[model samples]
Target: MTRAPWMAVIGLVACAAPAERSLTADPGAETTPVRPTHPSGIWPVTPPGADSPDTPDPPGSATNCDPLHLVATDIDETLTTDNDEWDLQIDDPSYDPAMRPDANTLLQGYAARGYTIAYVTARWDFEMSDGRLASEHTVDWLHDHGFPLHGGLVFLAPEPDHDGDEVVEYKSGVLLGLQAEGWALDWAYGNAETDIEAFLLAGFPDDSTFLVGDRAGELEVPGIPNEDAYTAHLAHLASVPDVRCE
Candidate 1:
């Protein structure tokens, strides 16, 4: 399938807030502009030059940026890449990415500006929040690194109650269920086509639900805010405009 490319500049509203934001807490204030990229300053890295290629624009001709909300990015692509995660979780007792360079700077920027930085994923479920072997294993793995997720909703392999048709339908129903429960969701970011299904369910009406990474022909919706999964995830965040936390 042909992927759509759309670019819509969302309006930015600057606001004041306390620094030293906590990753354990949810979003609290106005959204901030994208920060400068922080550098690990490793010699092996290639410093970006003046002749770098243009960042790819959004698809579907882009959507009008929502003034009230900012984009939500995928953890794998936007925060860290597959390779990096692999290294961290390479010898996982339960298989979780280390998430080095944590993207704390970026997340902090968003938090200071009041924009919600949600770490959306299909990793696990609410039932696993505590110490369930499955949940504990996944949570422990992510925590070992610095994922900076406030809360998470895990998807434990489709349900046995749903029929073939219902399986897809139910995966979506989960989001609606969360919202009905009063989860504070300003935006969403996730990987994969099924990941976007919730965007549609939640109403594909804002820039808050941006896509990151290269899924190629897997999706039809326009994912703005792209990033590299696992290995490149940190590098991509490093490529963000004005990122300076390091």
Candidate 2:
């Protein structure tokens, strides 16, 4: 994970609204072996959402109110960049720290409010020379960037390509896997439609659960802050202290 500040890759769409700044992810190296930050922690578990135009997130409100679990984000177009690819380890320390996205900062806002944090992506699982599936390195990178995420998980992508539909289908497996092991989610976030997979599987059924991200297509859940970026979104919602991306 001792590489450069890179970009991301995942296919998603966005509205053609004007933006003050344009930030898109550059795909980075293939997935690597993640050295867990919390060896016993279930971080890789896909991690919630909302408020209103009139009302606001009360001080210490979401802690007892919001889901006490992870926030699932699409790394490529949504969180990092708006591309279909990522760049490999680049020691370019000045690659623009601003481009690194501040999820860890945001999670602290939520965690202070009392939720847990985790990151999940479609970065395929890694394989060893002997064909044995090894752990993924995306989490290591998260730690490298100070994302505050306890664990990270990658999808098992098909050879040809994996689309949003497949993501929608398998997300439940990931959630159940985490929940069965004692993880509970109150909110989720992402900047793409593929992010809907976790929501569909979550089936929270009320505004109590959140689905925040850059944009959510037809998700229609409450507590969801559809934004181009939470870091950017934070500027707008300065009225509240965004809990740690807890």
Tell me the tens digit of each residue's lDDT in model 2 across 1-246.
211122211111111212221111122322322222221222112211111112333444322333335444445444454443333322232232222255566655655544545445555544434332322234334544666442223333322257777666555545555465455655565555666556557553334333444454345654334343456645533443344432
TM-score of 2: 0.51
- The most accurate candidate by lDDT is 2
Q: Residue 159, candidate 2: how far off, in angstroms?
A: 6.3
What is the C-alpha lDDT profile of model 1 across 1-246, one tens digit per residue? Answer: 111111111111111222221111112323222221111000111112211112332321111123223334444444555535633543443355534244555454444333333333333222332333333343334444543232222233232243434433544454444345443345555555555665667554444454545753346643533433333433434333331121
Tell how far residue 130 is off in model 1, in angstroms: 17
lDDT of 2: 0.41
Per-model TM values vs. the true structure: 0.43, 0.51
Model 2 error, position 28 (Å):
21
In model 1, the Cα lDDT at residue 89 comes to 42
